[model samples]
Target: MITPLKAVLVGCGSMSRAWTAAAKDIPYLELTGFVDVVEDAARQRAAEYGSPTAVVSADLENTLDRTRPDIVFDCTVPEAHMPVTLTALHYGCHVLGEKPMADSLENARRMVAAASEAGRLYAVIQNRRYDPNIRRLKAFLDSGEIGPITTVHSDFFIGAHFGGFRDRMEHVLLLDMAIHTFDAARLLTGADPVSVYCKEWNPPGSWYEHGASAVAVFEMTGGIVYTYRGSWCAEGLPTTWESEWRFIGRQGSARWPGDERMQAQVVTESGGFLSTVRDAIIPPLPPGAKTGGHAGIIREFVQCIQAGTQPETICSDNIKSLAMVFAAVESAETGLPVSVSV
Candidate 1:
């Protein structure tokens, strides 16, 4: 039988629960250690996960040395991502980190360089891409049924009253939430950002200490234009977590109603003064593993590490998604369009 890859999990915060649960379902992965700034948190995670033999430590470096894991699962905050990833690389361990890559583009670049030097895989978990409905939408866009997508739009609205760090975070919407939609836009359109014009504001009756609403228009490669409107302070008529999306291509347009349902319209035939429009049948999605979200990403991360291949959210490729966030923020701050730096 093949030996399972040992893993050391860092950060015993809320997101760690999802990571630990996913690891349990992957037979090829063994959760060997749990690390957090607070030792009690790590201990609690180990106990909850039934990892009696798992090493629990407040010091990550010490835990890594003790466990000698094959990989490091980083569930830490964005600001700590770079340091955690670098430490893992130095220890000759692969890293699977939570999204947004890093707090800044410069740190993200450094992480990518370190991973390349270490010759180990470094992947970010963009779990939103693993949704079956998202997969179906991507497939439809790729099938040329959309015929070269030229425009895309997404709207996200939610009134979450989480009382924590996010309440006081700056650019809270762009940094914490919009990255999902930005990354999903790239996946669905297969395009990189060129430039973006953005506007950010805090609406009246908002609870966040900083910007909680924003609108951005991004120019992408192949002349594709993507627009985004999001608000974390919206109280009523909140959109689904996935966000509503509309994609317009030369031949047709597709819409995802922020849920599992999708619909498309295409022009069947056209003349000088007349045109015919019909519903474009969306194709069935391909078969995939039963697990998705964090679990799906975990499975792919392990498979890529074992196979010596790069996963979809490899740091190098994921940087573009991160760039979109920074670009939008920069535009909002400067009140001018800014070129996306990748």
Candidate 2:
């Protein structure tokens, strides 16, 4: 039998729980241990998960040398993803990192090149792309049920009570959250962004040190126009994050406003109809799937490791979406349209 890939997690934050649970369910992945800069946090997390092997990794080089796992998961802060990822690749291990790819496009490119030189699979944890609602939307678009998609719009509006890493961050909205919107836009439209212009604003009397709202217009490949509006501190929204997406095609359109408590619809040239919104449908699970994000992504990653193929939507694929966010940030900074080069 083919041996399961050995996996090591480099951070023990809130997302670690999901990662731990997902790893447990993937037979082809062996969870070696958890590592954190904070000794207590790492030990506590390991105890909570009933894992006896977790360790505090003050020196990553030493830890990796000892563990020699086949796959390294960099669930650390955005800024730290680069060093951890590059080190993992240098040590001849495949890497899967969380979103935003890296703190900057420059570092993201470097990481990509390192992965290429190492000849190992390098992927991003863009779990949102695996969302079932998104899958359903993609299916509808691909079926040409929505003909010649002309316009796309999405929102990541939320009134999050800031804490942890997000509270003390800079460029709050674009850096911290826009990757999901940007990636989803690219995925939903099946196109690349060519040019972008954006306007950003920090809400008056808001607690955030950075801009909280941004609206961007993107010129996508195939002449599709994409618009995204997002805010980290919109008030009085019943949900924590209210995501709305609409695809207006030449012959039809589709919209997913939220889950069951809300509603989604499709309008074709023939007629308009409301999609069946099951009440218990949860956000992370998306819409069409029997299972959801963490589980789905882990399954795919395991398959990729065994098949020796990069996941279709890997970090390299996500680079274009990251470029979109940077383009918007550039637009917001220079007050001019910015073209996406990647």
> Best-fitting candidate, measured by lDDT?
1
TM agreement with the true structure for every prediction: 0.97, 0.88
Q: Which stretches of candidate 1 lie over 4 Å from their true place?
A: 1-3, 272-274, 289-291
Question: Candidate 2: where is the Cα deviation over 4 Å?
Answer: 53-56, 238-242, 260-291
Q: Model 2, range 218-290, lDDT digits (tens) per residue? A: 9999999998888888877633242787777765556777442322234422434744322222224334452
Worst 10 residues of 2 by lDDT: 277-286
Give the C-alpha miss distance for residue 322 in model 1, angstroms.
0.5
Q: Write the per-residue lDDT of candidate 1 for residues 1-342, one digit (tens) a residue.
A: 455799999989999999888888888788999999989989988988887899999999998899999999999988899999999999999999998799999999999999999999999999999888899878888999869999999999999898899999999999999999999999999999999999999999999999999999999999999999999999999899899999999988899976779999988898758568799888877776223889899998898878778899998999999999999999999999999997
Cα-based lDDT at residue 315, candidate 1: 88
